[model samples]
Target: MVIPETFFAERTSLLKASEIRELLKWVAEGGIISFGGGMPSPATFPRQQIIEAITEGISEHGDKLLQYGTTQGLNELRSELKNFMEWRGINVSNVDDIVVLSGSQQGLDMFGKVFIDEGDVVLMELPAYLAAINAFKLYDPEFVGLKMDDDGIIMDSLESVLKELKSKHKKVKFLYTVPTCQNPTGVTLSVERRKRLLELASEYDFLIIEDDPYSLILYEPIDVAPLKSMDGEGRVTYLSTFSKILSPGLRLGWVLADARLIKKFVLAKQGMDLCTSPLLQYIAYVALKRKVIQENLSKIRGLYKTKRDKMLEALETYFPEGCKWTTPIGGLFIFAWVPERVNTKELIQDCIKKYGIAYVPGQSFFVDESGTNTMRLNFSYPAMDEIEEGIKRLGQAIKERL
Candidate 1:
């Protein structure tokens, strides 16, 4: 008797698997130069210091680190993160309020677990971080896509959405934003827009989840404060990570929210992995103490800026005329737009099949129906030479289709 077995929660059915990661698996098989993933260049990693820290980490706290540690995370490490953010202008006086997660991605997942419920309305930027869409989808939250421009999420559209939601007798639970150096599109939120958003959040009485991992890696200094920093009543749940600047393998990130909300997040973390890796936490602590973090960050900013510049130049030179892309002030991605008739999903397939070049279609990043002609190109992993060659190959690929 063949009984069909269905083993899954209803939430799992709504979520789509990562398209870029799935594509990368096959792209890897081709041995073609790839730019589909947002991986940092290994050359910029502080391997020497990390090695020294790890060696010293185990030597100083072998038994304590290897074993399970506090659910809230290593207190000393959280304090360091607090101090770091304070320097950056996020005003957090108490370190106990922060909960260290495996990474910022995990922090997002936990936030969803705490806040999102079936049928609750959530506002997200159109063409946002695919992982955030997936994470929120797991809770079956009703998503509203806010339009985006060079200054970041469109204020008029945001107002319209809020008004519409209000008229319907529904209020949004939260508005998710990437603010500085957004995913897919590397547009930084302007100071004016930031204030406007905070005002909107205050008026509507909804939270703003500010995901800002790439803000610190900017090529030049930008005087924009995090949404959390401007938040008066603890309305912003801010999250950032060490994945881009230090190392992804560390899997270290922290979330800053009101102490009340953080309690629930801590409980969620308790069930997830008990705690983040104590060994890595120790290493981070030592690195922070030794001031290796600042040095490594400087190196990363310089190296990635060079890569980004090369890619931008290549795009200018090689891509067809009339094609448009944002000149990112910071971050690993550059979003390009072709004609509306061009289906980027199909283009991705064709490029991979014909030219052996890969990119993520921008459609997947948007919750509302938009961005069909858009694609996201990562400029972080490839070297200067690879950026030139890859962009040339991609340009050649696009021209062939044209």
Candidate 2:
């Protein structure tokens, strides 16, 4: 049978396939200790509570859950998220401003569909989330990278990019960021930077899509509010998820925006799935209603804190002199930089073969430049003992390479 070329959208040709997923497939078959993926430890998930919540939902809601539901998602689920955000000092007056997504990744995809068009400009941190890069790339959006440092993406660099785009008479659809505990870097943007970012967004008249799935897992008390909290004009779209906190299996998350924009997202979501799984939403609602999410988050925060500390400590003790990494206040991963001569892409394979340990090269995270001498080490999944050994293996791999 012959196939038509028009069966696929022309925009799909723009995206390179996901490198992380390819690496993970190889790593999973290697039978080695791994720290590659930024996956939370399933050991920390509230399996029992999830079971209870699902049972309760089935008992209480029955076929209502098994049937089609509103495109805006369950009203009670949206209400629960609104209250949760309110506790964080973020105010969303209309409950309709929120839309339920399968997870924050789906939220990114939906936003890409609604806001991004052919040749539209989308700004992102230099080394940003790969999934966001992949999701947005498929829409043929032009990506501009803002400079980054230990304190997160530099404000001046962001301003320069925005100014340049403005001068060229270009309209940037949105800037994507994981402000707190950013992926691949694990650096939190300071409160001052966060406010400055919002100011720049206002000046440029673009949107900031703040993807913050890890903020709630902070190890220390955070004084900085979300960009959405400071946004009075409804320019920032906030996305959060239950995946990192309660259960990834649930695939439940929420998107907060202006009611008008949310209406667009609702239409986009309707085309994607009509609605998020009713059964999953009902179970999540029950979990929140019963305080199961809170309980699970507490447990996860404590466990990941210890894991993060152990990995940081190992970096200090085991890595060679001049090696550097960020000491994140909270998060599952840390980015390590070796001397410029050392290529982490090659080193990771050596570490896997020689020491039965693995980590992800930072090259895959960047949009323009490939970071060959850097690596991102995930600390959440490995136990304390395993972390020590993994670090030792990684360090040995580096030393041998040198």
Candidate 3:
């Protein structure tokens, strides 16, 4: 089954497996205490409701649900999603502006396919989502890592980078951001900073892709709105998912952009999968109609808040000196920085095989490959007791390495 190296495409070299995904397979085998994947807790899924929705949707629309659908997605789901976006203050004047994705992850890959030419500039946070980095790597863009503070991306650093890029006469294709409750770092952009980012995007004449999957899962009340909602120039493409709120199994997510861009997304998505499954789209349609997602948000917030607190408390009680982690008000990960002497990617193997613990090392998350001393831990997937024990084992492993 092995192919010769000569048979492979040049882009095949960009296809690296996700560290979280490979680690989750081990976690599924049930020996390790995993702080790896950014997975929603099973407790958050509306099991009974999902079962009912699936059954009912099939019963009522068996002819359509079982068949292939349009590439732009179901009229029902897009119509429902339009209202959903409006509720969140995202402007959508037409249902044609929405393009349902198989998942937001697919949107990332499509963005690269749709936008990037080789050597094009794409700005990303210093410690970004590993999957997005991987997805975009396929198109061979020069990923410039923007400096981020606790309150999301630094404006001064971004403006300076933009100015320099302009001086070089290089165009930035788009600045991909998870602005609210960013991945790995779990930082939220301030409202002021959001305005500034939009301002800079306008000034520099670059597009913005706002990958927003975690803004609604707040533990504390934050006033920050999604950048797309604030975008005045139609430059931001707003992408989000039902994975956090409803069910990841549905594989339902969506993108909201200008009608012109939606046309391109539809064309791009047509070749990708034809369409997101009509059956799953029907389930999402039903869930939204019944207000299942809205009702479940409060419960999810409370469950994850307790879990986040437990992990934070455990780190304080167990992790050694010269280690610190983020205190996220929302989102699944707590990014940690250990001693510079420790390369977290190297430390993780001993932690897994020897200490029965796993985490996503931060090096792959950094486009610049500078976060060798960092790691990302997820609290939402594991139980509180597992969080405590896993953090202890992880701390011991880091200490042994140190």
Best by lDDT: 3
- Candidate 3 residue-wise lDDT, 99-182, digit = tens: 999999889988998899999999999998889999999999999999998999999999999999999999999999999888
lDDT of candidate 1 over 1-402, digit per residue (tens): 664436666566686779888877965686666778888888878888889888887887788889999988898898998888898899996888888889899998997899998899999898889999988889988999998999999899999989999999997999999999999799999999999999999899999999999988899789998888888888898999988978888999888888898899889998899999999988778777778888788888988898899999999999987689998889999999977778888888777777777888889898986888888999998668878988898888777667
Clashing pairs in 3: none
Q: For every candidate structure, what is the RMSD over all alpha carbons to the true structure, in angstroms?
A: 1.5, 1.9, 0.9
Model 1: residues with Cα > 4 Å off, grouped in runs: 1-5
TM-scores of all models? 0.97, 0.95, 0.99
Mark the regions of model 3 whose C-alpha exceeds 4 Å error after superposition: none
Candidate 2 lDDT over 302-352, as tens digits, reads 999999988988888899976999888777779889988998887877776
Answer with 2 or 3, whichever has the higher lDDT.
3
What RMSD does model 2 have?
A: 1.9
Steric collisions counted per model: 0, 0, 0
Better of 1 and 3 by lDDT: 3
